[model samples]
Target: MKTYQTSHIRNIVLMGSSKSGKTTLAETMLYEGKVIDRRGTVEAKTTVSDNTEVEQMYQRSIYSTPLYTEFMDHKLNFVDTPGSDDFVGGMISAFRVASTCVMLVNAQHGVEVGTEIFGRHAADYKRPMIFGVNQLDAEKANWENTIDSLRQSFGKRVALVQFPVNPGVGFDSFVDVLMMKMYKFVDENGTREEYDIPAELMDQALELQASLMEVAAESEEALMEKYFDVGELTREEMIRGLYLGFQQGILNPVFCLSAKKDIGVKRLMEFIINVAPAPSARLEVLPDESTLECNADGPTVLFVYKTALEQHLGEVSYFKVMSGKLTEGQDLVNPETGAKERISAIYAVAGKKREKVSEMMAGDIGCTVKLKTVKTNQTLCAPGVEYVLQPIVFPQAKFRTAIKAVNEKDEEKLGDALNKYSAEDPTITVQYAKELKQTILCGQGEHHINILKWHLNNVHKIDVELYAPRISYRETITKVACADYRHKKQSGGAGQFGEVHLLIEPFVEGAPQNNRFKVDGKEMVLNIKGKEEYTMDWGGKLEFYNCIVGGSIDARFMPAILKGIMEKMEEGPLTGSYARDIRVYVYDGKMHPVDSNEISFKLASRNAFKEAFRNAGPKIMEPVYSVEIMVPSDNMGDVMSDLQNRRAMIEGMSSQKGFEILKARVPLAELYKYSTTLSSLTSGRATFTMEFLEYAQVPSDVQEKLLKAYQEEEKED
Candidate 1:
C-alpha cells in the first residue's frame, strides 16, 4: 500500500443510536470503496466493524473500530463507534481523534435519545457533523418526518444536500441538489446510474438547493456578497461555501442512504471525499494549550487514542499520526513515561483486517502491535522532539457494584482481568474500597457492567457475583461534650495506669478554637499551649489541642492520645464508619511515671473519645450526588414520581427538543440501580449523569435504621 499524505486523508467517526444501521452503513461504505468485494450484514456476524465475539452475539457494536478505505485517490479513515450510551467511552474517544462525525439518523425514528446524547457530545467536542438518514429501504422509513425532526433538533443547521426520491420498502434512488443529478440504484451492490432530475421532484430539489446555498453563503462574507449580487452560486462557489460552513460547524448537511441496499452509499462517500475537511484542516491541540499542524515534514509524533486485546494480536494500539511520518521499525520515546519503544510493524486497519504498510503520514490513523509500555491517551515522539497531546477525558462512572469471585482462588485472576479491561475501556473503573471491604466495579450503567461480566464469565472463565455496593457514609458530632477515661491494668510486674480528660466539639471551617466551655453548669477554662490540625482523608478535619498545664502529662504521649482519637474516628462510636469535622482538647489528665506508657494512654484516650462521641449530638451523613436526567416528555411524570420516591430533591427542570431535562440532588444510597430502573420506567428513552456533591446529614429515621443495622452487625461479629 502507498502512503497517503496528510492532505489526502480524511478522518471521520460514525455515530448515532443503537440499531441505527451504523455497522451496515460502514459495511456499505467499505464495499463502495472497493476494500470489500461484497458487503457483510450485522445479522450474519460478518461485518468488519462488529467482529468482536460479544458484539456478534449481541449483533451490535461494542467498541470503536477504526477502518480505512482508499477511494477517489484518497485514504478515507473512519471509526464506527457503538451507539449505546452504555458504551459511550468509544464515542468520546472517537470524537477526540476524528475531524467530523457522521451522525446516522434512523429514517423511521427520527432523532432518538441516543442521537441526542451523541449529538450533544459532538457539539461539546466542537466536531462538525454530516447527517446520514439510513435504513430508507425499511418498510416504515419516513424521510419527511426525519427531516422535520432534524430541523427541530438542530434548527437551520440541517442543510439538505440530498433527499430520497422514493423512500420505504421500494426505495432505490435520491436526488442530489449539490450536483442537480438523480442517483438511481439498479441493484443493492452500489450499482447506480445517473439521470436528469424528474419534473415531479425538480421544484422540491431546486428549493432545497437554494436553501442549502443560502446556508452555505453564510459561511463567509465573500460568498454572501457573491450570492447577493448574482442571486445564485456557481457549482465551485457553492462547494467552497459548503466546505467552509461544514468545517466550521455552521452547517450539518443531510444526505439520504439505504445502507442495506447500498443505495446512495457511493454518493455519500463522494461527498465526503470532495467536501469533508482533510486531516490538515484543523490543528491538533497540545497539552500546554498550544496547537500543532499535521505537517509531514515536521518531527514525528503519534497519539494513541485506543487499545484493544485481540484474539491473536497481544495488544493492538490505534493511533493518529500528529506530525511528520511514522515508518516501520522507527524508535519513539513516550515523553510522559520516558520509555523508549520501537514500532515493529504498522498496518492500515479495517476492523479486524490489517494490511501492512511501510509508513503512514501525519494525520493518518492506523494501528501498531507489540509496544512495551504505550497505552491509550499517551503520546510518542521522535527521539529529539517532545510533544504530548491533550488526553481524552472520559465521563465519570454512574453505576457501581461490589464484585467478588465465587471461588476464592480466582480472586487474583479476577483482579488481573479487571485491570486489563479497565485499561482497554477507561470508563470501566475498579477500586478496592477499604471502608466497605469490597472490590467495587463502576461503569456507565448496569448494561455496561453486565457486558464486562459476560467477558469475565466467558473469556476469563471466572465466575463472579455482583451485589449492591455499600455507601460510604460519614459520622460527625453536632454539639459539644466532655468525658474522662482511666486505664489501669495490674499484673505481677509493674502495673499500667493512665488517665485522659478530653472535651469534644464540632469543628466548623474557618472557625476559631474555643478555650472556655460550660459543662454541667460549671465553666472550665483551658490554656491551650499547642495545637495540631490534620485534614482527614475521608472528608473533613480534626483539630487536636494540647491544654496541659505544668506538664501534668508529658508531650511524648500526645501523639499516642491523638492516635487513639483517630482510631475511634476511623470507626465511629454510633456506627463503624469514618468520622470527620471534630475538634479534641486534652484539657487535663493524670499519669504515673512508671505506668505512663503510650499503650496505656492510647487505650484510655480511645475509651474516652468513644464515650464522649456517643454523648455528643452524633449524626450520620450520607453522600449526595448532583444528578441530571434527560427523559422524553412522555415519560417525564413517571420519572419524576420515581425520583420523588427515592427522596430526591428536584433542583430544576427544562425542555430541549422533545426531551425534558430534570436536575436533582439524590443520596448515593438511594441511587443504586437507578440507571436500570430509569431504563425500565421510560422504556430506555431516558439517560442521566451523577456527580458527587456535598455530604448532608441523613434523616432521623434513616439514622435510626443505620444505627440498628450496625448494632446487629456488631452482635453478629
Candidate 2:
C-alpha cells in the first residue's frame, strides 16, 4: 500500500439509526472505489463493515469497523459504526477519531432517536457532517417530509445538495443543485447519464440553490460580501465557502441516496473526497495548552481509538496518526502507562482484512498487531516527548446483572474472558459488588450484554447465567440512645475484663436552631495516633468524644475501641449492610491493665455499639437515582404513571423538540429491568439515562421484607 499525505486523506465516520443503510453505503463506496469486487447487503450478511459473527447473527453492526477506499486520488478512511444505541460506545469512539461524520437518515422513518443521539454527539465533538437521506427507493419513502423533519430536528443549517426526482420504487435519478444538472442512473452498475434539470422543477431547484449559496456565504466575510454584491456565487467560490462552512459547523450538506440500488453513491463519494475537511484542517490543543497542526513531519503522536481480538492474531490495535508519520517499525511510548511499544506492522484495514503498509501518514487510520501495552484511548508519542491526547469518555453502564459460571471450574475463566471483552469495549464494565456478594456485569442495555453472553458461549466455550443484581442497601440511625456492656470472661490462663458506656445518636451537621435533640456538647477534634482526625468523612461519622475525665479508658485503647465500632458498622446489627451517619461517645469505661487489652476492649465496644444501635430507631436506606426520560408527548402520561407506580418522585418536567423530558428520583431496586419495560411501553421510541443520587430511607413495607429475607438467609447459613 502507498502512503498518502495528510492533505489527501479524509477520515470520516458513518453513523445513524439502525437499518439506515450505513453498512450498505459502506459496501457501495468500497465497490465504487474498486477496493471490493462487488457490493454486499446487510440481509445477505456480506457487508464488509458488519463482519463479526455476532453482527452477522443479528444482521446488525455490533462493533465499529474501519475500511479504506481510494477515491479521486484521495485516501478515504471510513469507520462504519453501529446504529443501535446499545453500541453507542462504538459510535463515540469513531467520532473521537474522525474529522467528519456522515449521518444517514432513513427516508421512510425520518429522524429517529438514534439520529438525534448521533447528531447531538456530532455537535458535542464539533464534527462537520453531511446528512445522507438513504433508502430513497423504499416503498414508503417520503422525501419532502423527511427533509422537513431534518430541518425541524436539526436546524436551518441543513442545506440540500441533491433532490430525488422519482423517489420510491423507481428512484434512479436526482437533481444535483450545485451543478444544476440531473444525474440519472441508467444501469445497476452505477452508470449515470447527466442532463439538464427538468423545466417543471427548475424554479424549486433555483430557490434551494439560493438557500445553499447563503449558507456557504456565511462561512467567510469575503464570500458574504461577494454574494451580497452580485446576488450569486461562482461554482469555485461556492465549493470553497461550503468547505469553510462545514469546518466551522455552520453548514450541514444534505444528499439523497439509494445505497442498495447504487444510486447517487458515486457522487456522494466524490463530494466527500472533494468537500470534507482533512485532518490537518482541524486544530488540536496540546498538553501545554498550545495548538498544533496535523503535520506529517512533526513529532510522532498516535491515538488508539479502537481495539479488537482477532481469531488467529492476539490483539489488533487501531489508531490514527495524530501527528507526524508512523512507520512500520517505529517505537512509541504510551504516556498513560509509561510503557514503550514497538510497532510490528502497519496495515490498511478493510473490515477484518489487512493490507500491509510500510507507513501511515498523519490523519490516516491504520491497525497494528500485537502491541502488548497499547490499549484503546491511549496516546502513543515519541519517547520522551510527553504528549498526551484527550481520551474518549464512554457513557456509564445503565443495565447490570449478576453473572456466574455454570461450572465452578469456569469461574476464573469467566472472569478472564469478561476482562478481555471489557478491554475491547469500554462500555462493558465488570465489577465485584462486595457488599452484595455478586459479580456484576454492566452495559448499555440487555442487548449489549446478550451479545457478550453469546461471545462467551460460542467463542470461549463458557456457559454462564445472568440474574438481577442485588441492591446495595445501607443502615443508619434516626434517633439517639445510650447503652453499656462489659466483657468479663475468665479462662484461667487469661481473663478478658472490660466495660464500655457509650451514647449513640444520629449525626446531622447544621442542625436547626430550635431542634431539642441537638447535642449541647462542645465539638472536640482528636488526632488519632496513625489515622487522620475524625471529620465525618462518610456522609456521617462515628464522632467519638474522649469524655474519660477519670482516665477510665486509655487514649491508646480508644483507637482500638473505634476500630471495633467500625467492624460492627461494616455489618450492621439489624442487617448485614454497611452502616453510616452516627455519633459515638465513650463517656466512661473500666479497664484492667493485664486483662483489658485491645481485644477485650474491642469486644466490649462492639457489644455496646450493637446494643445501642438496636435501641435507636435504625432505618434501612436505598440508593436513589436521578433519571431523565425522553419520550414522545403521546406517551407522556403512560410513562409518568409508570414512574409514579415505581414510587418515583417526579422532580421536574419540560419539553424538548417533540419529546417530553421527565426528571425523577427512583430507587435502584425498581429500575432493575426498567429499560426493557420502557422499550415495550413506548415501542422502543423513548430513551432514558440515570445517575446515582443520595440514599433515602426505604418504605416501611420494603424495610420489613428486606429484614425478613436477611433473617431467613442467616438462618439457612
Candidate 3:
C-alpha cells in the first residue's frame, strides 16, 4: 500500500439513527471504489461495516467500524457508527478522530430523533457536516418533507447540492444543482450518464442552482464580490466557494442517495473527495492545551481512539497518526503510561479485512495488533517526545443495575468479563458499591446493558441476573434523646462490666456547640474536656465530646468508645444505613478496674449509641438526582405526568427546535428503569440525563416501610 500525504487523506464518520442505511451506504462506497467486488446487504449480515456476530444478530452496528477506500487517488477513511443512543460511545469516539461527519437521514422518516441527537453532537464537536438523505427508493419516501425538516432544524445552512428526481419506488436519478446536470443511473450497479437539464425540469433546477450559488458565495469574500459583479459563478469558482463554506461549518450540503440500489453512491464519494476538509485543514488540540499541526516531517505521534479483542488476533488497537509518519517495527512510548510499545505491524482496516501496510503518514487511520500497554484515548509518541492527545469525554451513565452471576463460583469470572467489556466500550462501567454490598453496572440505557448481557450469556458462557440496585440511603436524627446501656458478662478467669450514659443530639453546620442540655425535664450541664470532629467517608460528620467529670471514664479508653460508636454510624441503627450529622457526649459511664478492657467499653458504647439513636427522632434519607429531559412538544405533558408519578419535583421547562426541555429533581430510587419508561412513553423519541443532587429526608410513610423491611430482613438473617 502507498502512504498518502495529509492533503490526500479524508477522514469522515457515518452517523444517523438506526435503519438509516449507513452500513449499506458504506458497502456501496467500498464497491464503487473497487475495494470490494460485490455489495453486501445488511439483512444478509455480510456488510463490511457490521461484521461482528453480535451486530449480525441484531442487524445493527454496535461498535464503530473503521473502513478505508482508495477513491480518485486519495485514501478515504470513514467510521460507521451505531445510531442508537444506547451505543452513543461509538459515535462520540468517531467524532473525536474524524474531521467530517456524513449525517444520514432516512428519507421516509425525514428528521428523526436520532438525526436531531447526532446533529447536536456534531455541532457540539464543531465538525463539518454533510447531510445524506438515504433510502430514496423506499415506498414512503418524501423528499419535500425531508428538505423542509432539514431547513427547520438547520435553518439556511441546509444547502441543496442534489435533490432526488423520482424520490419514491423506481427512483434512479437525481439533478446536481452545483454541476447543473442530471445524473441518470441505468442499472443497480452505479452506471451513470450525465445529461443536460431536461426542458420539463429546467425551471426548478435553475432556481435551486441559483440558491446554491448564493449560499456558496457567502462563504468567501472574493467569491461574494465576483458573484455580485457577474451575478453568477463558474463551476470551478462555485466548487471553491462550497468547499470553503463547508469547511468553515457555515453551510451543510445535502446530497441524495439510494444506498440499496447504489444510486448516487459514487457521486457522494466524489463530492467528499472534492469538498471535504483535508486532514491538515485544522490544528489538532493536545491534552496540554497545545495544538499540533499535521506534518509528515514532524515527530511521529499516534492517538488510539479504539481497542478491541478479535477472535484470532489478540487485540487490535486503532489509531490516527497525529504527526509525522509511523512505520512498521517503529518503537514509541506511551506518554500517559510511560511504557514503550513497538509498532510491529500496520494494516489498513476494512471491518474484518485488514490489508498490510508498511507505513502510514500523518492524518492516516490504521491499526496495529499486540501492543503491551496501549488503550483507548492514549497517545504514543517518539522516544524523546512526551506528548498526549486530548481524550474523548464520554457521557455519564444514566441506567444502573446490580449484576450477579447465577453460580457463586463464577463471580470472579463475571467480574473479568465485565472488565473486558468495559475496556472495549467505556460506557459500560462497573463498580462495587460497598454500602449496598452489590456490584453495580451502569450504562446509557437498558438496551446497552442487555447487549452486554447477551455477550456474557452467549460468548462468555456466564449466566447472570440483573436486578434493581439498592439505594445508598442515609440515616440521621431529627430531635435529641438519651439512653444508657450496661454490658456485664461473667466468664471463666476474667469478667466484663461496663456502663455508658451518653447524650445524643442532632449536629447542624454553623450551629454553636452546646455543653448544656435538658433531658426528661431535667437540666444537666457537661464539662468539656476534649472534643474531636471527624468527617465521615459517606457524607456528613461525626462530632464526639468527652465530658466525663472527675475521671468518670478513663481518657485512654475514649478512642475505643468512639470506635464502638463508629461501627453503629456506618451501619445505622434505624435501617442499617450510614448515619451522619450527629453529636455524642459521653457525659457519664461506669467501668470495672479488671473488666474495663477495650472490648467491654466498645460493646457498652455500641449499645448505648444504638439505643440513643432509636430514642431520638430517627429519619431515613434517600438520594435525589437532578434530571433533565428532552422530548417533543407533543409528548411533554405525558412525560411530565409520568415524572410526577415518580415523586419528581419539576424545576423548569422550555422549548428549543421543536423539542421541549424539562428539568426535575427525582429520587434515585424512583429512577430505576426511567430511561426505558421515557422511551416507551415517547415512542423512543425522548432523551434525558441525570446527576446526583443532594440527600433529602424521605416521607414518613416511606420511612415506615423501609424500617419494616429492614426489620424483616434482620429477622430472616
Candidate 4:
C-alpha cells in the first residue's frame, strides 16, 4: 500500500453500547467502500472487526479491532470497540488514535450506560464526535422518541441534522432535514432511489428543518445576521453553519441509518466526507496543548495511544501523527521520561493486519516498530520540538483480582507478559502486594480484567488464575509505651554487648507516613524513606537533654541501634506490616565504645521494639475502599442491602444512564470477591468500581480474631 498523508485519512471510531449494531454498521461502511464484497453478520462472526473466535462465539466485540476502507479520496479507517464496561480499554485506545468517534446509538434503548461512558471520554479528550442513531428498521424504534431520550439522557445540546422519515414498519430511509430533501431506498436489498420529500412527511420535515436551521443560525454571528436580513439561511450558508457548529462542539449532527438493510448507508458516507470535520478540523489539538490550532507545519509528533505485543512479529507502536510527517528510522525522543529511541518501521493498521508504509504525515493514525522506550501517554517528538501532546485522562481502574500463573513453570513469563500489557494499556494496572505475597491486577470491571487474561492465554501462551485482589491493610499503635533490651555475648574472641530504650507512641490521626530514628549510643545509623535511613529527626539528643549527659551509652554505638530500629519498623510490630508515622526515641542507653558495633546494637534494638509493641497497644487496621456501583434504580434496594452485608457505609450518590450511582465505603477484604458476587446478583449487567480510599481501625472483635489467626498460621509455618 502506498503511504497516505494525514489529510487523506479519515480516522473514525465506532463506539456504543453492546449489541448496538456498531460492528454491522462498520461492515456496511466497508461494503459501500467496496473493501469487502460479502458482509458477515455478527452471529456468523465473519465481520472484519469482530474477527476473534471468542467474539464470534459470544457474538460481541471484546476488544477494539481496527478496520480500514478507501472511500474514493478518503482513507476511512474505523475501529469497532466493545460496548461492555469490561472492555473499556478498547474504547480508550481506539478513541486516542481516531480524530472522530462515530457513536452508534440504539434507537430502541436510547442513551445507555456504555454510551454515556464513551461520550464522557470524547468530551474529556475534546475529540469531535458524531452520533449515529442506527437500526431504524428495527421495531420499537421511534426517531422522535430517540431524540427526546437523547436530550433527556445526554442533554439538549445535541443537534439533529437529519431525522428518520419512515418509521420502523414503513421504514423507507432517512431524510436530510438540513438539505430539505429525502433519500429513500427501494428495498432492503441495497438498492437506492432519490426523490422529493414524501408528500406526507414534508410538513414535519420542514418544521424540523427550520428548527435545525434556527439552532445552526444561533451558533454563528454571520448566520444569525443572514437569517435576520433575508429571514432565511441560504443552502450553502446552512451547511457551513452546521459544520462550524459541529467543529466547536455546538452541533452534534445526528444521522439515521439501518446498517442491516444498508439503507441510508451511502448518505452517511457522503456526510462523513462533507459535514464531518476533516483531520485538520477535528478539534484543533495542540502538541504543547495551550489551546492549539490544527496546523500542518507544526512540529512532527504523534501520541502513542497504545502498544501491542505480537507473539512473533514483536512490539508494534500505534499512534496518531498530530503534526508534521514522521518517517521510518527517525530519531524519536519520549517527552515523558526523556528517553530517546529511533523508529524502525511505520505500518498503517488495518483490522488485525497491517500494510507496510515508509512514512506517515500529520493527522494520520498508524503504528511503528522497535520502540522499546516509547509508551502510552508518551509523546514521540523529532528533536528540539519539545511538545507534550495531551493524553486522554481516563478513569482509574477500580476492579481488583489476584492473578496466578496457570502453569507455575511460566510464572515469570506471565509476569513479563502482564507488564507488557499494562504498559501498552494505561487503564489496566498491575501491582504486587508484598504482604499478601500475591500479584494483584486492577481494571475498570470484571470484563476488562477477563480480556487481559484471554489475551495473555491466547496471544502470549501464558495462562493465569484470577481471584480477588488482596486488601492492603495495616497495623499501628493506638497508645504509647516504653521498653528496653540488653544483649551480652562472650562466646568468641570479640564479644557483643548492647542496650536500647525506646518510647513507642502512635502518631496523630492520618499522620504523615515518614518515620524518624536517631542514635543515642555508640553505633552509626541510617534513616531511609520507606525502609530505614535517617539518623535524626532533631539535633540527635533524646528525652531529657541531660538524660545521657554522662555518656551512659557511647555515641559510637548510636548507628547500630538506629539500623535495628529501621529494620524493625519495616518488619512491623504485630502483623508484619510496614510501620510508619511513629517516632522512635532512644533517650537513655549504655553502649561499650570498643565491643558494641552496629550489629551488636542492632540485635538489642530489634528485641527492644518487639517488647515495646506489646505494651504500646499496636492494633491492626484494615483497608476500606470507596466503591460506586452503577445499577438500574430498580436494583437500588438490592445493591444497598448487598453493601450492608459487606460491612459498608454508604456515602453519597446520584442517577445516570437509567441507573443509580450508589456510593459506599466498604472494607476491601469483603470487596475483593465482589466482582463475581456482584455479577451474579446483577446478572452481569450491574457495574461497580472501587478505589483504595483509606485504612481504618478494625473493631476489637475482628482484630482479636485476626491476631489469633495470624498466630496459628505462624505456628503452622
lDDT of 1 at 122: 91
TM of each candidate vs. truth: 0.98, 0.94, 0.96, 0.87
Q: Model 3, stretches more than 4 Å misplaced?
A: 509-531
Regions of model 1 farther than 4 Å from truth: none
Candidate 2: residue 676 lDDT (0-100): 83
The residue pairs in collision within model 1 are: none
lDDT of 1 by residue, 465-523 (tens): 99999989999999889999999998778888889999999999999778998876789
User: What would the per-residue lDDT of candidate 2 be over residues 167-240, giving only the tens digit for each residue?
Assistant: 99989999998999999998877899999999998998999899889998999999999999999999889999
* Cα lDDT of model 3 by residue, 1-717, tens digit: 678888999999999999999999999989988889999999999999999889999999988899999999999999999999999998899888789999999999988889999998999999999999999999999999999999998899999998888999999989999888999999999999999988999899999999999999999999999999999999999999999999889999999999999999888899999999888887987767789988899999999999998888998999999999999999999988899999999999999889999999999999999999999999999999987878989998999999999999999999999999899999889999999999999999999999999999999999999999999999999878888888898878788887888989999999998988888788988888889999999999899999898787888888889999999999999889999999999989998888888888889999999999998889999999999999999998899889989999999988998899999999999999999999999989998999999989999999999999999999999
Clashes of each: 0, 0, 0, 20
Best by TM-score: 1
Which model, 2 or 4, shows the larger TM-score?
2
Identify the runs in model 4 with alpha carbons over 4 angstroms from their true place: 1-8, 139-145, 165-170, 187-190, 225-231, 282-293, 328-345, 455-463, 490-494, 509-547, 592-595, 628-635, 653-664, 673-689
TM-score, candidate number 2 = 0.94
Native-to-model Cα distance after best TM-score fit, residue 387 in candidate 1, in Å: 1.5
Query: By lDDT, who's the top model here?
Result: 3
Summing lDDT over every window of 10 consecutive residues in candidate 4, give the lowest-scoring window. Answer: 538-547
- The residue ranges of model 2 lying beyond 4 angstroms of the native Cα positions read 286-288, 509-540
Write model 4 residue lDDT over 1-717, tens digit each, in one string: 666655677778888888889999888888887777888889877888887777887789876877777776787877888888677776777776676778888888787767776787778766677888888888888787778877875675687878777668668767788667877788765688767888898888888778778877987998999888887887788888877877777767788878888887777777777766567765545655565434467777778877777767777877888787878888878877888988788876666667777877777777787887776777888788777776766667767789999779998898898888787677788878776899988877766787777788887788789875655556677666668898889787998888887666665644553333322333423232122323223111111111233566676666677668767766666667665545565656777766777787889888887788777778778877888887777777877888888889988889876778888998988876587677677766577777877678888988888878778878999
TM-score, candidate 4, is: 0.87
